[model samples]
Target: MDALITEAKNGDKEAFVRLIRMNKQSLYKTAWIYLRDEQDIADALQNTILSCYENIQRLREPKYFKTWLMRILINECKDILRQKNHAAELDDFAEGVHCEELNLCEWKQLLLCLDKESRKIVELYYFDEFSVKEISALLEMNSNTVSTKLSRARAKLKKVIRR
Candidate 1:
């Protein structure tokens, strides 16, 4: 695995493609949790993959490839959110029609009420199934900080959901 990342970092296109294939599901899931809309998820995933390919060499720790890739994906999602005014506007034609259901709409509204960092923590924890330790490493924060943020995020989420 490390060898593949090293090769990809060295500009091996095939190795990069293989690495993306291996991690695509996780990447998409992360995007999905962040964006909720299929089109937004697709756009965020594409941007992350492209950015990872372009910036792979900048990764200082090759052994931490998964976390590195995840951080890239999170940044890409944040970029998309900022670019689109933090409002994921999905077309009716999109396949993964999340907005069609009332339950998903309520969930999305609740998520949107969260500040970006809180939303990110919630997504990384609940959706991506990352541990607090893993999230701290990926986000370059202390584990205690991550735990505190998660608690605050859950409180905020609960407050929003109750409304």
Candidate 2:
């Protein structure tokens, strides 16, 4: 992989393509975490590939290629997420859905039963599918504490659903 990165940094197009192929699965999975639509995912992946190809020469550590690639992909995915949010807001406005007529989903109501902090934790863990370490780092909590909170949150949700 390091050799491939080296070749890519030297402007070898084939090596760049091979490197992108090697990280395709990881790139897709990371993009999926932030965007639901297939078009959005493809957009993010395409942008990531383009950005990596252009910047591969600037990467300082060949061994850290995957990490570098993932960081770029995450940034691209977040950009798409923000754009989607804005578009969806405009869409909802155009559709003229009344707030009063909107039904609260059981899942949303269940999440509301939790405290704000716990609600965020639950959303990051389940909805975003972030692992314990990822959530902990994002939330600045210890991994064990994140695990404990997730367990407690699950128990609370189950208890509520039983009613």
Candidate 3:
């Protein structure tokens, strides 16, 4: 991965493609936390790729590639959400029906009950395997806040499961 990042920074397109391919699943899942529309997800991904490609040289460290990529993707998702805020946000019932067709995993299905920010925090912790401290830094929250949210999200999940 470091080699790929180095190669990509040096203008090697194939290496860059390989790097993105390696992280495609993660990128989509991260985007999905903020976006329900497939088109929005695709748009965010396309924009992220373009931005990454253009700024690969600006990346300060190979080890931070995933973190950097995620930050860009998250920002793109936020931009899309902000742009679409004027539109009527889907209610829980509509969201459930819409998500049903997508056939998400049980965990992801439950995630829909969360607000987008909590959803992002939960997904970053569990799905992306980011530590609470890491998640706090990534999301610009305090570590205590991240831990509290994680605990509350878990409690919510537990309650949902009990129903």
Candidate 4:
């Protein structure tokens, strides 16, 4: 995978495409958590792919490719959300296809209760299994800030679950 990333960074289009394919499911899952409409998710993924390809050379660490790609996807999702000026309701999201790994209603409801940033932090930390430091780099946040947000999000979820 590191070799593929290095090749992609060095102008190998096929390697880049392979890299994208390898992480497509994770990309879609992250996008789905943020955007409700499938078309919106598709558009964001496409834009992220293009942005990543264009900026791959700037990436210093090949091992961070997944997180870097996720950061781009998150930014693209935020751009779409800003353009739309509204978030889709939980019902809209519930009607859509689910991620096989996280199809639980309780978990979905808990996630939906938090604001976007908090929800993203929670998802990336818990679902994607990214460490706080990794998440901070991916989200361009301070590590302490990521830890604080994770703590707050967990507190919020606990409160909601206890109700």
Candidate 5:
């Protein structure tokens, strides 16, 4: 893995492709969980890959490639969300397709009730199927903090769902 990363950093396209191929699923899943929209997930994954390729030279530790990639992915997602929020002020709905249904409405309402960080914790832990440790590392947070966030998020979700 270290050799592959070194080759990738040295402008080996094949090595870079291999690295992306190996982590594609995880990357896509992470994006999906965060964005909650297929197009957003796709865009975020592409951005992350491009950023990784462009900035591979900045990676000092080869063993931390996964962590670094995840950080980039998370940052991309956050940027997207920020842009979406800004656009929402001028538009009715941020670019996502919506269907008419009571359940869907309820789900959207439930999601809307969550604070951003809590929503992120819930999405990463439950929707992405990430372990608490993984979530902590990916979010650059302590495991105990992740656990607390998850608990609070779940409790909030339950309250919203019950109402």
Candidate 6:
């Protein structure tokens, strides 16, 4: 990963693209929690890629590339959310679609009840299988705080699912 980062930093576009491709699933999962619309996720991803390409040289620690990429993606997701907040709402064409037909996962439906921060914490810890310490580093929070939030989020998830 460090080697890839070094290559990307030195203007190797293919290496940069490959790096982004490798983390695409995780990035998309993170974006899904932030966005309900697929188009928004794509937009966020494109913006993230462009930003990373432009700023890869600014990264001082090559070993931390994955975390840095995630940080950029999170920011891009937040930006899309902010923009959507000010945009006029469009009617949902698929509002009547049945979940069963779509094969929507139970966990994804349950996760909708969480607030953004709690949802992010839950996704990172559970779906992505990132440890509490890793989540803290990605989110720039103290490890204790991350652990506490995870506990609270789990409690909230249980309560919601029981309903």
Which candidate number has the best TM-score? Answer: 4
Clashing pairs in 6: none
Give the Cα lDDT of each candidate. Answer: 0.77, 0.70, 0.79, 0.82, 0.77, 0.76
Once superposed on the true structure, which residue ranges of model 4 sit more than 4 Å away at CA?
Answer: 87-103, 112-115, 159-163
TM-score of 6: 0.76
Per-residue alpha-carbon lDDT of model 5 for 56-84, expressed as tens digits? 99999998898789889989988998988
Per-candidate Cα RMSD to the true structure, in Å, reads 5.6, 8.7, 4.9, 3.7, 5.9, 5.4
lDDT of 4 by residue, 49-124 (tens): 9999999999999988988888899899989999999873432232343465556675776687787778778777
Off by over 4 Å in 5: 86-133, 147-163
lDDT of 1 by residue, 1-163 (tens): 9899999989899999999999887788777766777788888888888888888999888777888888888788878899878654321111242433445556666677667776767766765678898899877899999999899888887786567
Alpha carbon lDDT at 56, candidate 2: 84
Q: In model 4, what is the error at residue 41, expressed in angstroms?
A: 0.8
Ranking by TM-score: 4, 3, 6, 1, 5, 2
Worst 10 residues of 6 by lDDT: 88-97
Flag regions of model 2 displaced more than 4 Å: 86-163
Deviation from truth (RMSD, Å), model 5: 5.9
* Candidate 1 segments whose C-alpha is farther than 4 A from its true place: 87-123, 148-163
Span of 10 residues, lowest total lDDT, candidate 5 = 87-96
Model 3 lDDT per residue over 59-140, tens place: 9989989889988998998899889885323222212222334344665577778776677777677666778876776788
lDDT order, best first, reads: 4, 3, 1, 5, 6, 2
